[model samples]
Target: MSCFENIAVEDIQSCINAEVPSGISEVNMNYAVHADIATFPVPLAIGAVGYTYAKANVIEEDIAFTAGKGFGKIKVQVNTGELTFDGVGSVGNMKQKSSLSFFIPSNDAQLLGFIRTRLNTPMVFAVPERQGQNRLLGDKFNPAYISEVKGTTGKTGEDDKGVQFTVSSFAIPLIYNGVIQEPAIIP
Candidate 1:
């Protein structure tokens, strides 16, 4: 008696209601060729996010050191200061060294060429995270820089995103204007 028995009205309603599902809207980067740190980042190829993909790897290492001069009172001291291993921390092992690396897709030729040309220059990257209801939830933008471009490559493997890339966002800064991944934000 039913022509479309598999179709449900609630499923249809749910799909229609789920507008802001938190998808990768856009990811773009710009570089300054042999430019000073004070210089603003110029768009590499303007607004182009064709087949865009981006990733960042953040590494945080623990800090540890020894603080004490000589083995004992009789040992005496040759150096003025205590023998200590230089590490990141004010007091004890309470600091971590953090660094970031990104894997970006070479979607546009002009942008890829810019990256190749300025492979050794300081660059600023602006990445925007937008959703359908970003207007209500307050979208966030992640900005970072690479002091020196360490590696460059182009490869195609059996399993790759059109081409080879590398990076994973870990210990990366995420300044949330409001709670993002929540039931209400996406709903």
Candidate 2:
């Protein structure tokens, strides 16, 4: 019943050598302010079988969100979106810090309004990775927040002009196993 007990060592001998695609193709953004359910995620119980660090840190159950309370899908540009994890393994705090970065091409009044609302809102981001894996950042306990938003109108016609968003959270991200249901954008 000890949390520090040694579990079976995982073996990587059967791993295959193959090229895997990188970078996020899309991000599902969920605002905590608009969520009907509480933001805190259900924590996994200790002593559960096959409870690894990756599984123990995140909720393994599917999240059911009502209409208009579900995630909003954002398509990321090629090579424009990525999530990074940084953590300290000290005894005092073993928490991990994760950051999600992506660019939204083009800027309009409607987009500005949406960006305004994100500045002060708590959020959760689900990013799709290779091999049909969905990675979730920001649980209920550690909701993500917009750390920075940089917009630029390029001087040259060929230069990129858009807004880049950096969403960050102090909680370790999870490998999502459930489907991400998108809410109706117009409803």
Candidate 3:
């Protein structure tokens, strides 16, 4: 029997009359060690929504945070934040590589030093979009790591000066349907 024969088939088209917006409005980041998140949703192969991956649309449970621990919020500027996915190999050995990139408008020494410590830390991020469902970028099984951090203080006064971070993972982003909580920070 052919491998295709065992796969479920269904319509995978989107709504033609619906409108979709663009851009991420906010990012909620937290250390993976301080939280527990559910795995990505998987399609039920033998169910009626098998081909459509209905259950993969949204996660219903919230991420469990350690006592007194919560996500750190970052407000993204227009056109400054985005998520990209690249397939690393062909179908037989394919892997989904997802990356989240965002710019921080500040380049303070203290903040720079704090971010520097995250080089080896695994993290999970929640990206809230302008007009769509919130997206969760990493989980316990497939955590995200800060691959790059670039801090710049531009020469010209009009030029942008800030830090850009690139977070990478081996999983696809999923719709998050839980409340995002952030702890108060003492200044």
Candidate 4:
């Protein structure tokens, strides 16, 4: 049995554009898998036995926008999973830990550029709710909110690929309420 047996394509599409702001000529969203820490060692060892394993499961949705004059934003959300580890031997054992984190900072210009460039094009994005609905959708789904442009690429020391944008604003549809709300700084 499939979980999406009664979902309408239009309804799903509607959810996609539910957060687009007014005056924005166009909007788009792309989904991608940002796998981090594919396998990490668990801190569990005994006697002469040792074990290590790490796994990261995350589904990211990248929302792109083009409100004229190159002014746009990319909002990404991550659904994370726990880390698993196991080790059993005559003289050894193993352990591991996992966490889910998705928060983008507000001063990463390079990361913003990278996302805008990669997600701006047309590509097949995965729909987490309905895995069978994996299809190519242009960057035009408006979200109910544009949380923050965060980075999950992890820390790279001096390399610092861990830059992200903390999006605290979003554009919702007028049908849900009255007039559209103007952009206000989130404190």
Candidate 5:
């Protein structure tokens, strides 16, 4: 059996929520937040065959990507110096240090809650078929699923240690929260 079977959807949702830091401000001007459940450590193994013992330990980092127009101008305060904007853009290549937040609706929240309730249950991360310009499909083509549970498991004890999990690519999807009074326009 695979270790993924031990994980529930709710566990993944909790990991997503836990990934979001506290005291952060949600995008309330003209944007919304949408989250999807992600699977890591593909082709997982629970020790050996016929054993209740499973290693479900994982680490998830906060994922914050830029959205909307003028997202590059978003400012974030850091100690004595404040990080300001040098340009206006989305989650692509831009130089700005802003801590923006996204919100979820009650229905999505309920769904996430339900997913969380299924942690430690037998589960498997599905690998979808790839056939387009979409990077997600390309990722699905790769069978390696790096778990974020450890920051140093795959790295050598050196100064050049790298991250274990694959970095999520950026996508510009329109988010709707029914909270924005108007759309944010960049000039």
Candidate 6:
């Protein structure tokens, strides 16, 4: 005999009208991956890795909206906050200040390899955005170097699995050229 109760239909896909917003798919996060070694405290190898700013995780993005109480108050716009994105990475490799115990800093292969060497080290602070959506979200802010280093030995829980690395860096806006990255809203 089957030892089971009634089977409920799961993973359902429904269609909505144009006015209604579609369900969320997945959020894409972007981190600073650079080719240089000067960004760090110690001398990283020729293959420094770019730290993953976030995981398939949660970021505490706080935004408040207010209206202007004047004679010509018509709409509500973002009057405060220059837009921010902060959270923990599953790896916990990036910190606000410089660290001495991290493995990547000591190991040349780890330092100058993979994510570290491939990430774009910006000159200033900014959020990543797609090339097409820059109009509404503003111009390409370029993921510049805005205090995206320095980290501590955080927990190893990991994102989408457990919890661990907490972000020491500040959140920046995402200005992509085509695809939308993490810490952003396309809908």
Tell me, by lDDT, which candidate is best: 2
lDDT of each: 0.26, 0.71, 0.69, 0.27, 0.24, 0.25
TM-score, model 6 to reference: 0.21
lDDT per residue (tens digit) for residues 23-140 in model 5: 3232212111221213222222344343332222211222232343221121212211111113335656553222222122223344344335422222111111111110111111
Clashes of 2: 2
Backbone clashes, candidate 6: 33
Compute the lDDT of residue 170 as modeled in candidate 6: 30
Residue range with the least summed lDDT across 10 consecutive positions in model 5: 129-138
What TM-score, to 2 decimals, does candidate 5 have? 0.15
Per-model TM-score, in order, reads 0.28, 0.81, 0.80, 0.19, 0.15, 0.21
**Model 1: residues >4 Å from true position, as ranges?**
1-24, 27-112, 131-187
lDDT assessment of candidate 3: 0.69
TM-score of 3: 0.80
| Winner by TM-score between candidate 5 and candidate 4 | 4
The weakest ten consecutive residues by lDDT in model 4 span: 169-178
Local accuracy of candidate 1 as per-residue lDDT tens digits, 22-99? 432233222211222222212212223321112112112211112221110111111211101123557744532323
Quick one: best TM-score, which candidate?
2
In Å, residue 181's CA in model 3 sits off its true spot by 2.8
* lDDT (tens digit, per residue) of candidate 6 on 55-81: 112222211112211111011111211
Q: TM-score-based ranking, best first? A: 2, 3, 1, 6, 4, 5
TM-score of 2: 0.81
lDDT of 3 by residue, 86-141 (tens): 88978888987889998888888767776876677777788877686777777546
- On residues 21-79, what C-alpha lDDT tens digit does candidate 4 reach at each position? 32211122223221211221222222213221211121123222222111123333333
Segments in model 6 whose C-alpha atoms lie over 4 Å from true places = 1-27, 31-120, 123-143, 154-177, 180-187
Task: Give me the runs in candidate 4 sitting further than 4 Å from their true place.
Answer: 1-110, 114-130, 134-142, 151-160, 163-187
Reference-based lDDT, residue 152, model 1:
33
